[model samples]
Target: MWKIGNIYFIAAVAVIGGALFGFDISSMSAIISTQPYLCQFNQRGHDENGLCLGPTDDVQGGITAAMPGGSWLGALVSGIVSDAFGRKTSIQLGAIIWIIGSVVVCASVNIPMLAIGRVINGFSVGICSAQVPVYISEISPPSKRGRLIGFQQWAITWGILIMFFICYGSSFIPGTAAFRLPWGLQAVPAVLLFLGLVFLPESPRWLAKKDRWEQAVEVLTLIHGKGDPNSPWVIRELSEIREVVEFERANADVSYFELFTPGMINRTQVGVFTQIWSQLTGMNVMMYYITYVFTMAGLSEPGTNAVLLPSGIQFVINVVMTVPALLWMDRWGRRPTLLVGAFLMCFWLCINAGLFAVYGRAPYPGEFTSTAESMAVEGPPAKAIIAATYLFVASFAPTWGPVSWTYPPELFPLRLRGKAVALCTSANWAFNFALAYFVPAAFANITWRVYLIFATFCAAMFLHVFFMFPETANKPLEEIEEMFDDTKPGAIKYIGTPAWKTKNTRNLALRQERNETLSSEEKMGVSGEHKESAA
Candidate 1:
């Protein structure tokens, strides 16, 4: 592929931050099914054999719930930091916390220590999740914005694939130390990311917003490649930045509460709820409990190669699908790809759930007749069910997977974008925590029913996108803002009101008068400053 620009190299650095974000997510899942971790609380737990557990259920549940609960705080606090500091600083802080969390996890001797460490790691991920995408989005050209942000999703999948193999590989090593080593392996990326970020620049757009124009120019020049700092490309982007900043300045200040103001409320609602809907899709439930799902599919043991194989392969699939997502996002248009992805997920999830339900309710032909005959049934439908489950994984890899991370940042106005993105991300982590903590219980009660619930959510998401979501594909940020402005009832009401009519008439005459002084080049979309007066 042709090198797009220095931004592509910058994207490479940005993706490492994303890799750490992804690594943290899939790291815990790797050891979730291992010994000591899985069987630690089992009362009558068996060692490497069909084991029984003590109050393993209650104790582990409490511990697991604590971890994601901490994650919730991590995600919530990330917004404040990202807004107060900058995305780059916040992400760097996240790396420090991640390293600390990893060390804590590696050395943990008790449940509280483990929980605290998980909380720290969770916090790091929360910040990385929000900041990495924003940083990538700010630095990216609009033509490649979708794909650039899409890289974050891809990195996450790669992390999952790596951890899955690490777990799979370690499972054969024959001791508690074996599994513990894999958990410690997460520290590698944390260290690499920390080192990498030191050499990277902050987002030029973000710097410009803070009125650090000179710094913004330097960063933009480096990101556009070692070009003359005053070149046309550099000049063009700086001009865009000035226009955007001026536009935002004249527009009303958008505070958190102002997020609910009449003219701005719809964007806020979409920004917040789209995140809520992403979680309701039940993606996390599967991600968090894939091991347990594997167990139920007849693994019968945690330390087996077979169990780890799927885990690794799932990760590989996630990474593979991500490439296509970035390629197709702009070409396909946002709404269609997203909606189609959702619907495909719904179909796959429903089929998986139904197959599992059938297997649970009735045995198949010629299978182990003992358990089947005891209940006048047949054999375990492990193969069919596991196949369907993996298919569901593939379904999520390209569709809801990338959209969940990309959509919020894409949809909001720049003024409210940070807080709105933060809130939506918080909602996502909240659901992520809930799903991670509760999936085991959900499975114990009715595995198939749990999936059915997710399938229903996916179907609903598909409909919601069809009716409500707009096509933001390949549109400049300015045009997207105007589109959302048109969606607001009060915006329309403001335009139609008598007060608005006078302002509109006055503004029109003012625009015509101003246009009379423009240079010829300026009239042709070059060499003139542009500004939007609306906040």
Candidate 2:
């Protein structure tokens, strides 16, 4: 509730930038197969029903892939902007860029214009996508971090659900305005994001990193203790942060290469691969091309309403399950949630592929006809395939969808958090780029077998998590640094027993020092600063 903490309001509003991010993602899906979309670019041999009579797979891929491409660049460079101008200001900068891109997309008259606009808008998302999680994570307390950080993904899904409905409604209008109107609506979120950040405080950790200690302390008190500068909890947080930031400053530099150093490599691997697994879950096949998937589902008329069913199912399930994810993450722990999700996703993908392998038919090329009405194997087979797709969505929505975005930021130390996030996010968009570029051609060429490949990847991801990932459920952020400093093999799984988890010799010494300082402060009758208490 807004009454509980200002960080909730700040984080909730700041991440509307993610709404524009989600808007661009699903917007093109609505228009791509529409008559106006295909005809506007002058596909010389394209039929009126939206299928190209000539080779246009690559063109379609370019239109869809441009945003991820732009996102890649924006993510790589976002850390520079975020570090130079604080997190709030960086988000504002990204919103301005998003609005510019939305204008270009709304006014697009051809395929090139459309692609260019998507890329530009995508660049803005890249910046937001990279920074939003980091910003949310920084302002949030260790106790409520999961719920707060997860809000960015929730905002993204809300944007997606809204845009999908908008597309369904706009399909009634005859002509390009149907798509143009929706494209321009993105400005609503983008502008709202810009205006909102003007009031939000900068990320306190970033202020601490910049050595603006007074501002950092002030912001931390405001968010964590309702503006009580002398709150004992705030003092403990400041001391804990000082330890981590001081260590990071002495040893770390903000660079892509720094992510791979021996001390930080584990964090880097977890961060990067978490993102890769998020992409390989095969979620995008449905996300960006549900219309195509439905058209092939043997429906007589794959109208907007018909297609809307699957997209709507996905959005609704995504919104519904996100709440449980926030609740379960802190209690059930990260590794359990992710591994179960991976296993279930693999199960669903196999079912999806098997149904298609036996009962489904590849879509007819060169004719966007309602041929499914006359096809031999209709009815249950198509419905079964749709069911399998929804099952996959159910498995993913509660788990990988939010975990991927939330977990990676927690992996990095605060000093290099911005760049580290950007690095992993680029890895995410990189795989997304590959999938978007190849999925169309794969559908045209291989059909149902594509699910088999993703299923295999899902299995591999499950194994990777079992071996590589650790359980960091309720531990303080500073304690996470000590966990990674441990070099023993399979060291992460040693949750309650290991030196890192047990508050080993080094931590024991720190505790003793904290007690001595607290004793001295108590004697002086001044409690403005307090030492961190043992967990």
Candidate 3:
């Protein structure tokens, strides 16, 4: 709640960490398409007449999908690393790997070398995505926690937009030298992230759990300097950490398979499905084939349209929308905000699908092909559909896009958070890879069905939230532990309606109307009747 210089520094560093993941998402797509890089290299492996020679179609797909592949591995490993080495070390390692990957990509002479570089970078991004939010959540005060964690997503969107613009601007600079500049420029943030970590204190909650009281105190001092280190605020946080640790110690040592045990099952389902929902919404699909999308709408070219203006705009919109997530998160509560946003996403994607389905049929003459290339089409109607889709991207950025990342860290209990996040977040990368690898192929074959598929996913998630996602706004972390219990069947259920229930429960009606009835009953001074109703 209080504005402090230290909070900004912590947020800024966390954002830089976020940027590493974001930049990688869009940066390589530009590199893959740039003629000076991709085309000339193809010619290099050609015969005397300049024809295909090195790295066949399958090899190229592997190279392009390198980061996603590595991310899957990195995410799988992040749980052990974050839990064993701590969040700081995990992030520091990610930065170092990212820098190496950037160098490899920048200096790569062949597809294999570039793919190797991307794999290294992808590993780093995976670790960051797994650990950074956990760190942010530990350090943040609950009041501002959602918004601060939301910053990671906001930063990611900005990073993607910035990378796109850099690629766009570089493309016009007239040579391979220009394209190389953008690849090289990516190294800067990674370098900064590596350097900035020197000043950052490790998570106080993490230290307390480890029984490093002196270290935890120092970290707390860093967060709440000039204010008494032993102030009630500081003590309250320490107590919460102790309670979390105690709770962990009390639970039986459950295996991963036990994640399906009733109470725990809901969160696992939410974590896994929410991530799947994110990809199925077609965000990654749009990202992977923005150039093709633009071209399909008759916007691609030997001219300015090659720049991926629609994605670039969406990136900027995402960045702008992220600015308020931190503030509104505490104000609106996570479930209401997330549900509202998810519902809006359903509406927007469905609308975009309808528009595209209506006008995007009947491919351009001679442009339609069996191969995975944009079917160049054009007109006012086409432009309208493209415009609508870009707006859809903007909507996603602020809502499901960022909320997906923030929710998992906050919702999961401390002991299992690392493993759960690692598994769920990796699933995200897996879906990302699937989308990136198959979207072009899907579009060429399935046409507007791709958008329809996304719309269906978003709609399903909207209904799921209306029925299940709990309200976690201003409540203290300890109070929400009940939601994570394995014994409570509807622990994940929010305060809503009886019809929203997954199974029949007699209390559902009273629970839904509990608040409205309480005030009126109190106004009439019917305390006995109110007491009887609660019973």
Q: Which candidate is the best by lDDT?
A: 2
For all candidates, what are the clash counts?
Answer: 9, 0, 2
- lDDT, residue 77, model 2: 84
Per-model lDDT: 0.65, 0.75, 0.68
Lowest lDDT sum, 10 consecutive residues, model 1, at 368-377
Over 4 Å off, model 1 = 1-5, 39-55, 65-67, 229-232, 301-305, 361-381, 486-535
Q: What is the C-alpha RMSD of each candidate to the true structure, in Å?
A: 8.4, 6.0, 9.1
In the range 161-237, model 2's lDDT, one tens digit per residue, is 88977876786777888888899998888888887777788888899988999988888777764556665557877
Where is model 3 more than 4 Å wrong at Cα? 1-5, 41-62, 254-263, 303-305, 309-311, 361-370, 486-535
Between prediction 2 and prediction 3, which has the larger lDDT? 2
Q: Name every residue pair that clashes in candidate 2.
A: none
Q: Return the clash pairs for model 1, or none.
A: 42-53, 42-54, 43-53, 43-54, 44-52, 45-52, 46-51, 161-315, 251-535
Put the candidates in TM-score order, highest first.
2, 3, 1
lDDT of 1 by residue, 179-278 (tens): 5776688888877777767777787777877888988898867765244565545666688678767777786675777777886676667666677777
